[model samples]
Target: MAHWFHRNPIKATNAVTFDFGGQASTPLARNICSEARSARSNLLTIFADPTRDLTVLTDAAEKYLSILRGFVEPTVDPNSQRPPAQAPNSEGGEVESMEVSSSATGDSKLRNAIKFTWSNTLAEKHSSQHDFVFEQINILFNIALWHTKHAAALAGAKEDIAEDDAKEVHKCLRSAAGIFNYIDDKLTVKLFERTGDGTDLDPNIIKAYAQQCTAEAQEVTVARAIELKHASNLVSSLAFETGKQFKIADNSLKAVEENLVQKWRKYLQLKATFYLSYAHCYNGQTLLAQDKCGEAVRALKESKTQFEKADDLGRSYTSTKGAGKSAKPHEHAFFRRLLPLVRRNLEKVERENGFIYYQKVPEVVPELPSKATYGLASPVEFVMPSKHEDWTAETYNGFKISKPDAEKREKEKDDAPKPVKEVPVNQTDKESSNSSGCTIS
Candidate 1:
């Protein structure tokens, strides 16, 4: 279970005390900056291990992000925008006052001179910037990653997980999805520029992470439906949707570095194939329940094909090189648990088709059941927190910024590369002895 998730590490950084010029009249700015930095440090350094408490890490993330908001525009007041960085994501979206340089925001007068240095998770190297927005984006990425880690912890618990724990798993994943969505929908457009694949702020990486979380959350929904013994159609519908979700996530990373992302892509591929098997297996059950022996026999055969494909991926997912721990999903009981069920169902249907129904098995597999009508996962709504009360415009405007290199800005604008976009795949199904998610590995 430790290897269940291929988590991206947080941006590491050296410390900086927010020491400003001696002209300041108040300690208010210093205190807020110090606490914000401390919270950030604490958040980044948390071990990526799943054994840690979820609530502790979650609170620390919010505390840091809310305080850091003070140093930026529109968050601190109706007006505090900063000067433009190298360039915007021009791939398209909302660009705030970030593009418009105006002294009225006190943006030109008080550049927050404290240089924030942070490492890129994939690049495994540090890049320093005077940008508060840089800190914001990185901090948001870490918190979202933490939620995925917590979901793993809950699912990987040594004891059988309780129903409430399943709910927590669902909640944690959706929370991760929401933060990632916020990054794509709101924050990335505000980025002075795309940090490229070397950095987590790259749009394609964000989309992949967002889709994975949303898909993983639905895996929980599938497990819950089975535990509750929901209808055959509902279970098959959900399982089909889960497979589709995993495909989208895998597709999002199509052009990401193979050395960096191949293992994760393999995990998505295996899961997609696994859940397609589930969808087929259950759709077969739905058909059997409705006495459509011909379709049931056909669907079961399709499930067998997908199941074999997932079994093949299990090995590759283990061998593939990439960041984070490699999962032993092939060996995990959760993965093998479906085989007996599929076999039993397929055997039953084939026997019935021959003796009772006398229906002919068709060559074509039935189309995948329609998308689930309900109980699918959606991102929890996320809005940037209001700036901490202590960070009034007066306190924020006191500090000046370290200006970005104008030359480098122009160069990056000319040199920025197009983003990588890929297609994806995925797993999970029923008659389980217990209720838990597939991502638990």
Candidate 2:
């Protein structure tokens, strides 16, 4: 479990007192700053061990986010750094994977009062910004990572995973995907600038992470179906969809620098291939059930070929250089147990074809399933936490913002075209749940 998932390191930052109160320090202002720091401290401490109780990890993350919202609430600026016309925060003309808000990205005096510094997930140099949105971005990113770690812990907690544990594992990965999507959708677009190489803020990296988490979550569901002895077609469909998700995730990394994520890519690639094998193996079972033993043999042969490819990729993944810790997915029974099952099915189908059905093996391979109908995983859409009550109107206007010089403000207006936002993902994802932000459906 320790090295099951690759995690970005916790960002290190120099502590800054959020003292926007200046000379007229109201009691509320001091309290706000104090509470903000305390919230941040608790979040950092909790992140140290993501394998703890699911509730504890999520609560800590959300608490910091809620209070931080008060600091980043929109403020008017004649010389806004963003474009006059707001655009979507999406790419490649796909549906907006995240909810894009029209609220102004804060250019407030308090926003620049405290600078936030965070190191890259790799050992690369860090990105530092005086903007409050920068802090929010880092917080949201780490929150997503914490959810992934929690999912990994649950999945590998024991060899024989309980039904409840599997459910939680599935839920956590979807939640993680939601957060990563949020960062890509809402927060990162608000940054004045991103000034670090190999930073986690890269859109391709975010998408890759999001896709991988979703695929991984679906993996748990597939295991559950198999464990419960679900119908062969159902399992095949689920496995096929899971592998497709992983492939999409792998393809997203094409634009990313290979040295930064070769191992990570290999891991995703093997998972993709491994799941394809699982799909074919189960598919062969389904074919055998229909007495199409010849077609079953063909599917099982393809399954065996995919399994071999995955095994070779597994060895390469272990040896490849990359950022983050190594993963031992091949060591898991969830992965190792598939080949024997495939072999057994192949043997049975070949014997049955010779004796019973007598159908000839076609010249071409049979088609693998296109997708899963019942258990295809999607991101558990994330909603940003509402501002804490401490950010009430009276408390909010208490601190006077230091006005920026007109010349400097004018100079800082970025002429860059705003990101075009895409359609929102489940804008209606409102359901009450105790697991984490959104209920696992």
Candidate 3:
């Protein structure tokens, strides 16, 4: 009966096209361009008149499409053959829907219906295949996260933004957060597949992918806490889960070399400790926001231990292997900035816990100049012409060399003579001034 109900293939191939505010051949290109237009219009409108005039759902949909594109279509250099050599790079897209046909006898009408249903038309294309592609998922997660960060940055930039407007932006963030978590959950399945009953696995590649996924999972949790303001208990629980995942990845590497394994474990432990510290700090902040002072203090105290361990590990690692080598400029700068802030947070928690403060609060340091703003504030260095170069006066017919019109107006104003008028005063005031030996000239 099931076989009798099967449908026959209606067509050998089907093409898909999208009309995204206009016609486009490819769905990806059409969707991207359409969203680009909407986003551009929204931003331009906002710039012209800073008001809550945006369609929030449309904005969220645009961001969602961005994440989808990042998953399905990666940026290409056009010249490079490889897809920018991202980790676990692969090609993936919506699978073409094809009806399964066999030599078995079945009703022709039913078969035709089945084939029509299975056809790779815009309305009937299979969607499950897209979810199986891991690279696309990761890219989508990252892009969604970038959108969340973008929204936060936008909120920070506009001082006069209304509460309702801010709430709209948060709605976008919430959607992004939800998608990110979904992908994270899906990635966990891939992690287990790689682990494969804890046996018969390559030491580096498979385990490395798992570790990468778990580490990114930790970051995703942190992002959730930051953007969603997840509950303190949930955030703390996630932090512990992240630590456990790191331990699992580390433990899997035991069959490898001792020194190598030890170093890997150390690095993993270092990361886990730092993430835990960040998580605890987040939990403390969450509690503090809810007016749970005691709980906040406790969470912050726990964070201090993890932070100290991370600091110690970082120092030890640098002193040993990085003895002669200087740290990267960004790393050096980040550590320099972060250390004091960590100290301050810890101090504040301690003070809240009724500890006496012997030392005065540290002076606030002004932010160092950013490299991006260097060109804005500093003049471009003028380079002298090379000795071998010939100097010539370049002239263009379209160019104007006369003084500007503003200068001419200023000259006319200066040349114009001024007219003066005499001031009138009350007779009594004038007489009093004269008696007091004072007079208006």
Which candidate number maximizes lDDT? 2
Which digits, one per residue and each the tens of the lDDT, describe model 3 over residues 1-441? 000000011111111111222212244444443453454334323321212334543454444344333222223334543311111212453212111121122111111110100111111222111121332343333334333333433343333446564544445444444454444444435422332222112334234334434343344444445456556456555555555555665666666545323433455566567656765665665655665556666666666777778777655544332101221211332223434545676566557555532333223321111221111111112121121111111111111112123444334311211111112111111212222111111
In model 3, what is the error at residue 194, expressed in angstroms? Answer: 16
| Cα-based lDDT at residue 180, candidate 2 | 90
Cα misplacement distance, residue 278 of candidate 3 (Å): 1.6
User: Between 1 and 3, whose TM-score is larger?
Assistant: 1
lDDT for 98 in candidate 2 is: 10
Task: Report the Cα lDDT for candidate 3.
Answer: 0.36
Q: Evaluate all candidate structures by whole-model CA lDDT and list the values in order.
A: 0.70, 0.71, 0.36
For model 2, how does the per-residue alpha-carbon lDDT over 219-256 read when each residue is reduced to its tens digit? 88788788889999999999999889999999988887
Clashes of 2: 5
Candidate with better lDDT, 1 vs 2: 2
Q: What is candidate 2's local distance difference test score?
A: 0.71
- Give per-candidate clash totals: 21, 5, 4
Please list the residue runs of candidate 2 whose C-alpha ends up more than 4 Å from where it truly belongs after superposition.
1-4, 19-24, 74-108, 404-441
